[model samples]
Target: MRLSSFFMPTLKETPTEAQIVSHRLMLRAGMIRQTSAGIYAWLPLGYRVLRKIEQIVREEQDAAGAQELLMPTIQSAELWRESGRYDDYGKEMLRITDRHDREMLFGPTNEEMITDIFRSFVKSYRQLPLNLYHIQWKFRDEIRPRFGVMRGREFLMKDAYSFDIDAAGARRSYQKMFLAYLRTFARIGLKAIPMRADTGPIGGDLSHEFIILAETGESGVFCHKDWMNLDVLKDAPGMEDDLQPFFDRITSIYAATDEKHDPANSPVPESDLVSARGIEVGHIFNFGTKYSKPMNAVVAGPNGESVPVEMGSYGIGVSRLMGAIIEASHDDNGIIWPDAVAPFNVGLINLKSGDAETDRVCAELYAKLEAAGLEVAYDDRDERPGAKFADMDLIGVPWQLVVGPRGLKNGVVELKRRATGEKEELPVEAALAKLLG
Candidate 1:
């Protein structure tokens, strides 16, 4: 991508309405724009990051044996009514009526609809332990939607539904999702701690919320200090393994949101506890018959008895994660995107764009980087060096390669790592080799 023709409309000043660091940085960096009080229009740069995150979530879900299938944004209110939650879901659900006077709604979640789908085709226990997921837009009419995408009313989400024959099978599915969520966050360069959380409207007895600690988090959290040292991918069991032991070990780590924390009753010593603010990015629930029984989503058991299939729902806030990442990773200069989720892997800055030598060097490097399967943003505009540097930093590409007439004359180019602010001067071949490696 060439910055000279890019559509990024970066702002020089912070918007007054942005109260949080993520919201302010996103606006100033031209990643997103507010279309309404709680809705945002993701621009090109932001959309790239969003899609990257979504793909990560999808990959993890697939690896955990969940199949992908998109669901509609508009849901039939009859389904919600069948699950006994149409009215109980409250004002957050955007209830509507079609021109023909049939009730409809923009779904906040898909428990009811998914249950209905399962019952339509799936019959005996042969189809047990099935998981289906989708990445789609969701809406909740928040009374006070603020902080950009963090608490936005309209946002993208990945929701998965798991169906099992019984409680034991359901727990297995839950554990798989638990491990998958941990791996998903880890791959995205986030250390998300799974904390016991309330099921809320989901009505589940067993639930966990995957939270990443950030100063700008919406809620306070308390956890065992050891959670920071744990490497989920290294320690977790395989997909086909008996996950009970792994699940037991993780749930015993003593993490909790403020709503569930009891300092006096906590097992961990005060000294071993780490209290911090955290943002919730994913949530999983094993709600055995919550939706299935109410909606008659039953299947024949081994004993030939009809039973409600145990069900679990997992959800990741696909859009809110962008704000969370910014909150956890940004610095005074701007966002410091993680390598896996960066919009562009590298930003090629031509300090003197009009200079033939500098432009030639930058163009060559850009071509090489792209040929090596890297996403490169080449700054080819006739802009000042400082402005180019600032814009590169603001957008948070993982690396920045600086080329100038002086550097070209010296037979070297400057490379900077965005996260660490480390710089090195190396020959063009050396730089290419390092980047390719």
Candidate 2:
């Protein structure tokens, strides 16, 4: 992609309404534009990052043995009514009426809808351990939507619903999703700590929220200091393997959101406790028969008895992760995107755009990088060197390749790593090799 043809409308000053660094940076970087009170239009750069995040979540869900499917944003109100949550869901639910005057809603979640789908076709215990998931847009008219996408009225989410025949099967499904969440966040360069959390309206007896510690986070969390050093991905259990031991190892540690924290009853000593503000990135629930029982989503058991399938729902805030990642990874300049979620792998800058030698060198490097399966954003515009550097940094590409007449004359170019601010002057070939490696 060439900057000359790119539609990034970067701003020089921060918007007053943006209270958080992620919101401000996203606006100035031209990644997203607010189209309404709480809704946003993700621009080209933002959409790329969003899709990358979505794909990571999708891959992790697949690895956990969940099948993918699409669900509609609008749902029949009758489903929610059957689940006894239409009115209980409160003002957040966007109730609607169709042309035929039938009740409908822009679904905030899909538990009711998914239950209906399950009971429609799945009739026996043979399809017991099925998990279905989808990545889709959702709306929940937040009364006070703020902090950009972090608390937006509309957002993208990856929600997976699990159906099992009994409590034991449901627990296994929950453990699988817990492990999947850990791996998903790690792949996105985040160390998300799983903490006991309230199930809220989802009405689950067992629930966990995966949170990333950040100074700008909205909620306070307490956990054992050892959580900082534990890497859940170090020895991941197989999908079909019994995961109780793995689950026990993680949940044994003391970790909780403020609502669940009890200092006096905590097992970990106060000296070993770490308190910090954290942003929630993912949540998983083992709801037993919460949705299935209420909606009469039953299947025949092995004994030929009708039974409500045990169910669990797992959610990862696909769009909110953009803000959470920025909160955890950015510096004073702008966002410091992780390599896995960066929109482009490299930013190629022709410091002297019109200079024949500099342009030739940058063009060659860009082509070589692309050929090596890298995504490159070439700044071919006639802009000042400082302006080009600032824009590239703001957009947060993992690497920046600088080419200038002086560097070209010396048969070398500059390669800079965005995260570490490390720079090396090397031959074009050497730079390409380093980047590829």
Q: Write down the lDDT of every candidate, Cα atoms only.
A: 0.93, 0.93
**TM-score of every model versus the real structure:** 0.99, 0.99
Off by over 4 Å in 1: none
Across residues 1-437, which tens digit of lDDT does each residue of candidate 2 receive? 99999999999999999999999999999999999988999999999999999999999999989999999999999999999999999999999999999999999999999999999999999977999999999999999999999999999999999999999999999999999998899999999998887899998899999999999898989989988888777776887888999889988888888877888897778899999999999999989888888899999999999999999999999999999999999998898999999999999999888888887778888888899899999999999989999999998999999989988889899999999999999999998899999
| Candidate 1 residue lDDT tens string, 110-189 | 99888888999999998787999999999999999999999999999999999999889999999999999989999999
Name model 2 segments beyond 4 Å from true: none
Model 2 clash pairs are none
- Candidate 1's displacement at residue 175, Å, is 0.3
